[model samples]
Each structure stands twice: as structure tokens, then as C-alpha cells.
Target: MLFKEVIGQESIKENLIQTVVNERISHAQMFQGKLGSGSFSLALAYAQFVFCSNKEENDSCGACPSCLKINTLTHPDLHFSFPVQILGNLKKSDDFISEFREMMISNPYSTEQDWYGKNENENKKGIIGVDESKELFRKLSLKSYEGGYKVAIIWLAENMNIASANKLLKLIEEPPEKTLLFLVVEDLEKILATIISRTQIIRLKSLSEVQISNQLANHHGVDEAKAIEISTYVNGDFAMALHEVSSQDNSQVFFDLFVSWMRLCFKKDVVGAVAFSANIQKLGKEKQKAFLLFVLNLFQKSLLGNFSGMENVKITPSHKEFIEKFMPYVHERNMEALHTDMSQAYYHIDRNANAKILFLDLSFILFKLIKK
Candidate 1:
């Protein structure tokens, strides 16, 4: 992956290039960003840039042997450690190397949910176990195969167990000569403080709507208007934008659910809302969180439309009519309350709260807040 291939983050790319050019590369660094923000892609590109023999000023020379190997994730010096389902004897990420490479090749912006899909198992959680840390140490202990930097890119580093984190901390604290560690994290809070203290943190912001829209149109061949709509709807999440394009039915389901839930809230139908909450609980925690995020994004857009005027609102034709009708209710008076409660609901759902009861309480709150 070259810097040119990663969408947006132009400033970050320049800064990373400067680090390499000035020989100020940190031995241990953390690339922190939300999912679908292209942090992983950026980190991979950075590593490739470091390894490239014929490096260009702005990006890596893709035709170079090092670039080719790194692009295919087959470089001896470039190592990867990621969360893995410890199924039977398959305990380490190396055990799932082929699948991991395939996933990255297919979609560099893949989420943990996409990782789960590759295994066809969503129920079992993935983790960076202590054994993975042991493997990391062993790999890094070896001399760089190409007599260059040995780079280890750990994806979803927050999933590391306490033991794994501690082991990694030692490596960070006293890293081997010519070794680089890139910890790619989605949740910075989940990482151990000791580990964080040792590494330079590179924060990545979300991609712009235009960036995502251009990628959708140019690379994915999505129609211009629909691509822009999805880019706006996903709120800078490129992975979600891709999902929205490929899974229109899923978006329709979320739309129908949102419409029904809003109706229940607007009418103050507690009984109906509670029943609806029960059904939503059946979608499982991940889907439940996705739904709540969808609703939150819509509410935000609606509030924007209300305050900024409808001309500023970029919504799909399917949702435009309903949102225009709903915009007035999500004004300054209730917008804060709505955002707070919905965000809290999403947070709790992610932490495995009782979804049915939580959704019920949220529904009742929305009933009062929506029309305030």
C-alpha cells in the first residue's frame, strides 16, 4: 500500500515522509483512529515507504521489489499481529495469515465485523493473546532478513490481553536495534497506560465526505449522486460507505427501523416502543450498535438541516421526504438531549448492556425529547 492509495490524510502522509527523510523514525509508534478512517492503510503505506528502495518524494515507488513484497504483505521484514479467534489449536494470528492477507487485500478499510465475517463466526470474540506476544518477540529477535528495519504492525492493538500488553510493553521499552513497532488502535482508552507511555501516538482524523465520495465514484464505479449521498450518510466512515453501497437492503432495514422508531417516539407510544425495543434486541449487540449509530447520524443530519436550511442537507431521495418532515423536531431545544442519550445508548450497547431494557428506556426518553 502506497501513501497515494490511502484516501485523504495528506498532512499525515507528509509528516510521516518527513520523519523518514529526517531519520527521526520512532522505534515504537501508535496509529490511533476510528474504524474506517484509513489508519491501517496509512501505517502499511508508511512501512512500505520505509522499506522501498526507490522512494519518491510523496510516495513509494510501487515498481520496486520491496514495494511489491510489502504490497502483497509478503515482505520478510514486515510482520503483522492482529486479533484472532483461538479456534481449537489455531491460536495465533500467523495461523490465520492467509485469511488475514485475503481480508486486507479485499478491503483495506475492513472493520472487526468484516474480520468476523471471514471466519463466519461473529459470536466468538477475537483477542491478541499472550502467545501472540511471545510470537512477536521471537520474530523481532531475528535479524532483519533484508538487513533493514524489522517492522511489526499490530492491528487492533487494543484487543491485547493484559499479559500480551505487558509483554509488548517490554519490547517497546527496550526495542531491538533497527526494529519498528506500529500499534494500530481503534480505542485508545482500552490500551494499557504503560504501553501508551512508551510510544509516539499518531492520531488520524476521519476522511472528508468528498474524499470518500471520490473513492466511491472513481474506484468502486458508484454513480455520482448515490456515491455522494452515501458519503454524506456514512459521515466520513469509508468502510460503512462501502457497506452501504454493497448492502442496500441493510440500509433499507435500518431506514425502516428508524422511521418506525421515530413514529413511536413522536406519538409517545410507550407500549409500542417497548415492543419494538424487544425486536431490536434480537439483532445482537453489533447490529444493535450499528442501528443506534445510524439513528444518531440521521438525527445529527436532521438537526443540521433544521439550523442550516434544507439546501445544506445532502440526503438520499429515499430519506429526503421523511427527514424533511422530521427536521423541525430535532432543533436546538432537544438536539443535545437526543445526541447525549443516543450516544450513551450506543456506548452501553457496545459494552454489552441489556439491550432490550436499554432501548426501552431510550425510547421513552426520546418520546419526551424529540418534540421538546
Candidate 2:
């Protein structure tokens, strides 16, 4: 991907371009950012630009042979290492390289969860193993086949196991001439300090709401109003905005359930809350997780609306209708208490706590808080 094609982050693009122009490119660099921030895309763009035979002033020439191969992620000199799961038949990320290429070509803004879903391995965990780290050394030890810089893009480098991370430390410290390593990391804290000290860290900022809305409108044919709505809810996450648009409309159901739960909480209706929890427990795990996240987002938006004075808060049509009627009940008096309760609920859900007991307990606490 050419740097020009990446949306927003004009300053970051300029900085990266200048690095190449000045010949000050670091041997190993870490592109650190939250999910959906385009860290991987930026790394790919930089790699393409670095290896492009016909490089332009600010970006790679897309028509060049190198650019073409990089665009398809088939560049002989460009290698990738990422997390993989050991399923029944699929043992490694390389085993599913075809799917990986297709997914990246289709949407580079995808999250780890999206990748897992595409591979139908959402229930399993993925990690970079010692074998993968050894393979990295093997690949880097050899000279470039195409007579250009060898680029290794390690996506989600923080997922590397202890052995892999330690093995990679020496490589990061000193690699062969004309070798570049781009480590895309979501959580910098998870990476070993030794590795961090060896690589130049480039922190990526999330796209602004305006940038997201504009891109959605131009690229996806979404109208300005709807694009803006999605942008607000997405909170600078392009992948999530795309998912929100692509997924089925379950906002009404979520809103109804949220309203009912809130009412049960306010009334101290323990029996009613228990029944409600039992009903929610019957939903699939993904649905349950989605519902919980939706509720969390809704609470955050409500708090922002009440205090942050950010008028651009976007809720679904049903949610807007409900919130308008419900806003008076969610003022400063109970906002903090509500946030605490919601956070506790999220913690419980994340730990695989019994959904029924978790929700019931949360409802009881909310009942006390709502009336406080």
C-alpha cells in the first residue's frame, strides 16, 4: 500500500517519508498503536517505499514491479510473521497464508478478532511460537533474492511467547546489512523491555472522527449523516465502524434490553433482574459479549453527553429516542456509580464468570446506585 492511500495521519506520513529521504531509517522499528489505528498499514507502506525500485518523492510508485508484488503481499524480499493457532488440521499461520493475503488485500484495517473470525478460530488463542522465531532467523540469515532490502514485518509482535521474544532480541539488536524489521504492536507494555530498547518506537494516533466520516463517505458510499453517526460510535476505530455498518441491525434489541435492565436496577426488582439475566444467558457467547460491549459503549456515551459537553455523541435512532427520555435520570449524581458498576460487569464478563450471576449481581448494584 502506498503512503498516499492511507487516510489521515498526514504528519506521520511526512515524518516517515523524511526518514527515508534523509537515509536515517532505523534497522528495527516498532509501530505501536491501538487496534484499528492503521499501524500495520503504515508499516506495509513504509516497507513498500523502502524496497520500491521506482520511489517517488513521498511514496512508492504503484506500477513498479516491487510495488506490485508488495501490493499483493508476494514480494520475495518482504516476509511476514504473525500469531497462529494450532487447530485440528491448521498448525501454523503459514498454513493459512492464502487466507491471510486475501484478508489483508480486502481490508488492511482488520483487528485480531476479525482475523480470528475469518479463520473460524475465534474460540482459540493465537501466538507466535519459538519455531516461528527460529524461522525468522533462518530467513534473515540468507541474502536478499531480488537484490533489494529484506523486510520482515512482524504483526502483533507482542503475542510472541517468551522463547520467541528472547530469541528475537539479538536480531533486533543487530541484523544483517540492508535488513529492516517492522514490528507492529498493539500493547507495547506486553513486549520485553530489552526488545523495546533496541527498536525505534513510532506511536500512531487514531484517526479523528472527521477523518473517519470523510473516508467512509468517499470510499464506502455512505452518506455524510450516516457516516458521521458511525464515526462517533466507532470512536476512531475504522475496523469497528466498518463492522458496525456490515453487521445486522441488533441495536433495537440491545436498546430494549438495556432499558429493561436499567428499570429493574432502579426498582430493586431482584426477581425481575434474575429472570432478565437468565434470558440473556441463553444467547450465544459472541452475542452476549457483543451485548455487554454495547452496553458499556452506551454508558460511556451517556456519561460523555452528560458532562463532556461533546454534542457529537451518536446513538442509534432507537438509542437516541431512549436516551432522550432517560437522560434526566443519568446525571452527575449517579454517573460515577453507574460507571463503576458497568466496569465491574465488564470485568466479570471478561473472566468468563457465570453470566446469570454476573448480570444479576450487577443489576442489584445498579438498583442501589440508580436510586442513590
Best by TM-score: 1
Output the number of the lDDT-best candidate.
1
Tell me how candidate 1 scores on lDDT.
0.89
Please give the CA lDDT of all the candidate structures: 0.89, 0.81
* Model 2 misplaced regions, further than 4 Å: 87-93, 223-226, 265-270, 273-372
Per-residue lDDT tens digits for candidate 2, residues 8-90, read 77888898899888999998999999657788899999999988888889999999999899989999888898888866665
Off by over 4 Å in 1: 233-235, 265-268, 281-314, 320-372
